[model samples]
Target: MKEADRCCGSAGSFSIIHHDLSMKVLERKISNIVTAKAEVVATSCPTCTMQLSYGLKSHGLTGQVMHPVQLLAKSY
Candidate 1:
């Protein structure tokens, strides 16, 4: 969560249209997740959830990504 405010580079179709650049940006986000030792990453953006999930798998990390609402629902 080091750069929680930073963009995951998904930006809707950005990741698919600019795969290389998107991956580069996603790498930074993934690094922060690793540094934070996150087991799950929660975000409200659907694109971010998909991007983060892909990033985690590509990095060989076993973390899960979910929407913030999903996390809140799980707490009930």
Candidate 2:
């Protein structure tokens, strides 16, 4: 999570409009996640959740990606 504040490259329809560039940005974000060895990735944005989930799967990594609220709910 080194660049936890960085965008996941799914800003609204930006990913769809600029697929290639979006993937590049997502790759960087995913790289940081991998480096952190995160077991779960939490994000408030639905787009980021989707992108992160896809990125993990694409990398053949089985990490959970969820909304912060969903994770909090699971903690109970």
Candidate 3:
């Protein structure tokens, strides 16, 4: 595949109302994605994609983030 499919911890309103909890969940997702050695992250939701990009940068990961459709378009 292009990248690992992991939740960005932006559980709709959860992230907006619960910052700490969202960060915690995002940390876990980031850890898993890092362990997987993903070169990039592709997500469907705009909010989730943005949150994942932030998480990657915050965790010092060098992985790029994009939407699944974007990846597909690039591949073709």
Candidates sorted by TM-score, descending order?
2, 1, 3
lDDT by residue for model 3 (36-55), tens: 78887777788888788899
C-alpha RMSD by candidate, in order: 1.0, 0.8, 2.8
Task: Put the candidates in lDDT order, highest first.
Answer: 2, 1, 3
The pairs that clash in candidate 3 are none
Off by more than 4 A, model 2 = none
Error of 3 at 58 (Å): 0.7
Q: Candidate 1: what lDDT?
A: 0.92
Better of 1 and 2 by lDDT: 2
Model 1 lDDT tens row, 1-76: 7988999989999888998999999999999999999999999888998899999999899999988888899989
Against the correct fold, how does model 2 do in TM-score? Answer: 0.95
Off by over 4 Å in 3: 1-6
Question: Which is the better candidate, 1 or 3, if ranked by TM-score?
Answer: 1
Clashing pairs in 2: none
Error of 3 at 12 (Å): 2.3
What's the lDDT for candidate 2?
Answer: 0.93
lDDT of 3: 0.81
